[model samples]
Target: MQFSADTMFPGDLFEAATRFAADTLAAGDRANAWQQAVAMGWPALLVDEARGGAGGTLADLGAVIEGCARHPVGLPLVRRCAQAPALLMAAGSAGADDTLRALCAGQVDLDVVDAPALTVTALADGGVRLDGVLEGVDAALPFTHVLVSAGALLLLVPQDALPAPTARFVGIDGAQIADRVLSGLLLPASAVLQRGEAASSAAAIAQDLAIFATTLDMAATLGATIEQCIAYLSTRVQFGVALATFQVLRHKVVEMYVDYESASVLLARLVADTVVTGRLAARDVALCKLYLNELARRGAEASIQLHGGMGLTAELPAGRLARRLLCAGFAQGDRLTQLARLATEPTAARL
Candidate 1:
């Protein structure tokens, strides 16, 4: 479906998320706020209507994520919204239907493991002998079930079967990270998402989902960084006058703005292309993902430098935001890896 700029703004969704964040911040229930944003409706929005999704386009998902990032919402909206749906689609399973509905209705938490190495991870072993520790399983702690994949096999595993520990580390974005170990976790035959070449399917889905998830992440970082740069230039003073008055600083701000706009445009176009063409627009998607993510990373660094000491402190959100963006930029696949994939793909090279 074609998305007009107006509808794509997702004004209602943005306002709801903003209000939710504000209330959560006031109540000191930040985690709940994040959960509400995801479970209340975002995941279902990305799924196809037949699968109990809201039938929203990728652009719509991007708009929701951008809005959430502008606030303090901590849930991994991009991963849940984009990755989960892509996994369900790739697996050709309606099994996620009830789960998606529950997610939309705020009745359950949804999480997915994109880690290729996780042995008992979702879709690992085609739902057979589960093994492997998955890294970066977003919101895994609260999730009832997780979609795990290794290559092409996708498996949905109940959380109770996995090993859990009580240590918590703060991620780059101030989100809690928990370490998990799975030792010979077994899955029933019914649990496996049966498909051919489980590894290849898992890899392709991971790459596709990474492109979608990381691109939106870049968009969020772009939005947050732009806001920070604008705020910095407007308030900071240098020399005898305001930094805004300096031509060099002004040029730098302009550069950041350009990067932000370019990334935004690229995100919009990538979503549109993905929606229209079901096949992997692997090259174009990679190009957009690499460019925008790297742009956001550089923009964050520039914002930090421009803001001076204040930027580095936890009191100011720029540093934290930058760290989060940087982590996300390198999260799914780093720029070098993405570029390498593109270079090696004969079809990508020709295009």
Candidate 2:
């Protein structure tokens, strides 16, 4: 069966994003993809209208994400548009207004890093020194700024203040990642985006929202990948008959469909809860993250297996979609990390 995200977003907006992704992202032009997405006001999707943004809801953002993911577009909409805007809203500071405007206008790109590896030292001059290595930060090339989460404090550092990434790699979906070594980098009090009890609380909420948003994007990608598998099975012939005609292969397709639909139902409820109540139950979000990760893994492997050797080749969408699904599973927090977090929750103590 064909999967469409028309119900999630306005028809015009969804179509526009799909067309753009197909035309631009098909060539792997993420830089141009970023610019075009900006021109379309995508970065402002989650920002408030009062703050020079469209003030759209998280579900609305999901629609755009789904549209792009239909072509398996790998732009960092979740990080830049959804998470960054939420962070700025939660940690508004003296220069945050200009930062938000620039971000929404696509004049700048930003990524949030939760660096447990970093050692933060408070200096007598009301500054802090940072030293450590930041691992697996999902950022675009030439990241103009980075929002560093060091313990209870959040620091916004410009690109020039830090050296080049110690290592760079590409994610399965074609986004850029960096591993940076921070050695005695100093930040004045002014660089602190937020701190203390209130800041810590806001940062946690922002992180939860980002994780939930990533799950939503993963669901979209998985759905599209399933559709890709179905299309492939229905067309390519072997032994003088279409693969879809085979009972075993058809059952595999059915299994994938069931997984996608089941996840969709759960995601629908969580998204609605978040929209109505303005937050998700932490336990529910964690559970959903793990479920979707496994679902993506299953779908990717199945798609690959069904396509045989060709599925592993980049020339086909199967490979790209599989890569994206596998990689996205690790975003926000990997399976092991999330599980450990759940183990520490108050509710988990009952078990």
Tens-digit per-residue lDDT, 8-79, candidate 2: 444676677778888875577777777777777887888888878888876777778877887766777777
State the lDDT of candidate 1 residue by residue for 37-137, as single tens digits. 66567777867776666887666766676666665445677566777666656555455455556556666565776656655344444446655566555
List candidate 2 stretches off by more than 4 Å.
Answer: 1-10, 95-98, 105-107, 137-140, 346-351
lDDT of 1: 0.65
347 in model 1: Cα distance from truth in Å? 3.7
Could you estimate the TM-score for every candidate? 0.84, 0.91
TM-score winner among the candidates? Answer: 2
Error of 1 at 103 (Å): 4.4
Return the number of clashes found in candidate 1: 18
- Model 1 segments beyond 4 Å from truth? 1-10, 21-28, 94-108, 118-127, 138-141, 166-169, 277-280, 346-351
